[model samples]
Target: MDTNVITPEGYAELQQELDTLWRHERPEVTRKVQWAASLGDRSENADYQYNKKRLREIDRRVRFLRNRLSKLRVVEYNPVQEGKAYFGAWVTLVDEDDQTLTFRIVGPDEIYGKQHYVSVHAPVVKACLGKAEGDEVRVRTPDSVKLWEIAEIRYGLAAADR
Candidate 1:
């Protein structure tokens, strides 16, 4: 559960977001705030208040993205990790009830908007780490312990292949 580890694609995505917020979005909000402020009425100006709040939010996100991008380590796929459940692995597991769940193991930051992604810090992912296809994994959650069989383990194409 190394919080600093992120897939190469995840890192690139974060970088792109930072670039967009800094280069495009922030400047637009700043201009809006200035234009709103120029309108005489300060107290009842809805545009000024709203755009000012948006400017603060954008600045906060830009600062956070800058800091997070600096500390993240982009983990590229390694040949040794092929066929094993590791970071950036697409894992499929079947439970005792025969229900199947599939997700890609990624960093905590990358799981926010992705339904098919699970954080490495999650209990299920922790149990599946280093396991191979057809291996049985015991996942202990706050509610109960469950058994899952690894049905498939796949990784994205290697960097060289791309």
Candidate 2:
């Protein structure tokens, strides 16, 4: 399997989520399932059915968290490597049209709920990696090639690492 690299903060966030799911959410769902089971016949009990399905979903997520945590390696800031972009770099880019966008390079699981976050495995991140501030990069899509200028770069904290 390919090794996954994540910032320290991202790792911590994943661990925190895992803890919440296993310690809190899982037990709560289990209890609901048991309570629903006590209400009526198994085939027709809606509560039991809902809670059972919820438990299965929770178990699946928990297992994914456990497996991912085991496989991912957290990348910590070294200060000396801050000038150019890497896994944790917060970069701002301006398109040829002068429209600017900012994003932090993160792992796949951390990509949700953030307007400016990009997965390290994404095409934009791959194009931005190893680039320094003021550098220019071109990203090719199936439709067209977008040319972007690196307006700024900062090795900012990953949410879990901070």
Candidate 3:
């Protein structure tokens, strides 16, 4: 399987979530399952049935997270990537309608809960790769091709300053 790319912050967040699930949530749920089981007649026990299902779901998620984290490569900000659109770059673009959109190019895992974060594999990012400020890019959508101009590009501390 291909390794997934993740930002340093995103990597840490995943690790913390894995630790919490393994050390805290799993144990608490396991205790509930045990308590429910001790009441006997598990086939008719609502608590037992519920907890058993919940435990399976939790374990599945834990396994998936562990495997995903193991295969992820945490990408840190690089000064060498300055002035061009790349992973972890904050980019501003002007669309054909003359409207401006600003977003950060990040990994697939980092886009959750962040409206302004675009995945590196997204068509817009693919079109913008290796493009510097003032460069034009073409994005092909299902309906038509759209034109966008790179208004600005920055990385690391410089990106935060903007």
Alpha-carbon lDDT of model 1? 0.89
TM-score of each: 0.92, 0.88, 0.89
Cα deviation in Å at residue 120, candidate 3? 1.1
**Alpha-carbon lDDT, every model:** 0.89, 0.84, 0.87
- State the lDDT of candidate 3 residue by residue for 2-39, as single tens digits: 22998887788889988998999899989999999999
Q: Pick the winner on lDDT between candidates 2 and 3.
A: 3
Stretches of candidate 2 off by over 4 Å are 1-3, 158-162
Preferred candidate (TM-score higher): 1 or 3: 1
Which ten-residue region of model 2 has the weakest summed lDDT? Answer: 153-162
How far residue 26's Cα lies from its native spot in candidate 2, in Å, is 1.5
Pick the TM-score winner: 1
Cα RMSD to the true fold for all candidates: 3.2, 2.5, 2.7
| lDDT comparing candidate 2 with the true structure | 0.84
Residue pairs in steric clash, candidate 2?
8-161, 9-160, 9-161
